[model samples]
Target: MSPALDVRRPALAHAPLLADPVAAALQAWVHADGVGVAAIDPDLADTAAFVEAYGVASDASANCVVVGGRRDGVERIAACVVLATTRADVNGIVRRALDVRKASFLPMDRAVELTGMEYGGITPIGLPADWLLLVDEAVTLAGRVIVGSGLRRSKIEVPGADLARLPRATVVPGLGRPVG
Candidate 1:
């Protein structure tokens, strides 16, 4: 069980609380032994509110942010998973990684449209196959982490090691830096 949540097995067990892609990913997860799901008030889905209301450690929460850039007129996109206590280094490391002249957070509508997920509820698990998934090394060492279920009404908990094994996931050291 999570520190303060009624975590249950098989994220697919709560299909109504997850986005279609999220549910599908859970269904196919090979190393899902420790993966769990927990329902939450939709309004508390944001990281800070969820942590304060549920008493989960900040470090145990991972936020997935979508970033995009263009290189030679071609668009490149990536999803970055970072611990809530820190922020992705988009302008520095991420920009260079994408080999783009500049990197910026994708607009909300575009992100939602591209990932088929609600705003504030985009998780790395079910991202589009073509997009890169960049996970912070810190997140991989965080034990169990709380990530979005692709819906504002629930969260998915999985061992950090399992996250690094997701398709297209690349563990990047220093991808996240402490937030000020």
Candidate 2:
């Protein structure tokens, strides 16, 4: 755990997402699932900034990127988790896994609206039920990791293996490639 970071229960945060029925349900689900939540300054919610400010190792921080594509004129979305040291293979691995021809990051507005989570605070725990959740194999091997808590003001820390066990989550090898 990052030093000086305050870990709290989701219900105590009073985050906007917790007020929404869907997000609230997801919050409860994560708690019951045994994930720990840590509150931080909203301004430092972005991965790089948070790591720099809080001394969290980048390799132990997971980033969740929302991707969108279409098949048969219907939109398909997925939430992909990868270590901050790597980039999700959105154009290749993720595209192939999702069975979509062209895949790109979901537009911010749509992602935020659909997940009911802040842009920099989306996690695999409470995503849309129908959307795919892909966890990079490396993430699951990293032991404990820091991830978003559905609110920019907080984050979740859990064993990587636990994230891989989220409902609808699939562990994909090479889902993320090392950053140059």
Candidate 3:
């Protein structure tokens, strides 16, 4: 295992299990389209947990990343991609690629308002039309993967190969190693 992955969010076993919005949004898509879908609830946000969430032997899960960028002097929000075992280097890749002066995580309220998904569930599937999406090469390697449901209560497992079918999504290698 990569040492980078070793520094993951520890599972608070006693902490109440919570809902995931990303999961819910993905499930909704599955039902509307009748696509085979499943949800992987992890006890923690660590790499190991995510790997377990997708039922992959290793880091096979895709990442549903959120980013905050300032465009035209206004703060805008976007989501990016990376392998679940990897992380989003938002400060470097997101900011430079988007040409934004300042980039940070979108505030909870703003993230919810823009994505129409509840906090913790933001997904790129039905994101704002103008919102920029930078899909990673690693994500496309997998036929299918799990992402945020736009709600913390659930997650959306979908076909990664067919992501471009959605309008206004640009597939690129914006995914990078996290600077955290």
Q: What are the models' TM-scores?
A: 0.95, 0.88, 0.67
Candidate closest to the true structure, highest TM-score: 1
Per lDDT, the best of the predicted structures is 1
Q: Which ranges of candidate 3 are over 4 A from the true structure?
A: 1-34, 39-50, 178-180
Cα lDDT tens digits, model 3, 47-130, are 455555434543455666668777778766667866666677787878876788878877778677766665555567667667
For candidate 2, write residues 15-131 as lDDT tens digits. Answer: 442325335555556543455566688899999999988898999999999998989999888899999999999999889877889999988998899987788988887788899
The C-alpha RMSD in Å for every predicted model, in order, reads 2.1, 2.9, 8.0
User: Model 2 Cα displacement at 163 (Å)?
Assistant: 0.8
Q: Write the per-residue lDDT of candidate 1 for residues 92-164, one digit (tens) a residue.
A: 9899889998999999999999999998889998899999899999999999999998988889898887889
The order of the candidates by TM-score, greatest first, is 1, 2, 3
Instruction: Predict model 3's lDDT versus the native.
Output: 0.56
On TM-score, the stronger of 2 and 3 is 2
Model 3 lDDT, residue 165, Cα: 49
Q: What are the runs in model 1 whose C-alpha is more than 4 Å off?
A: 1-4
RMSD of 1: 2.1
- Clash pairs (backbone) in predicted model 1: none
lDDT-sorted candidate list, best first: 1, 2, 3
In Å, residue 178's CA in model 1 sits off its true spot by 0.2
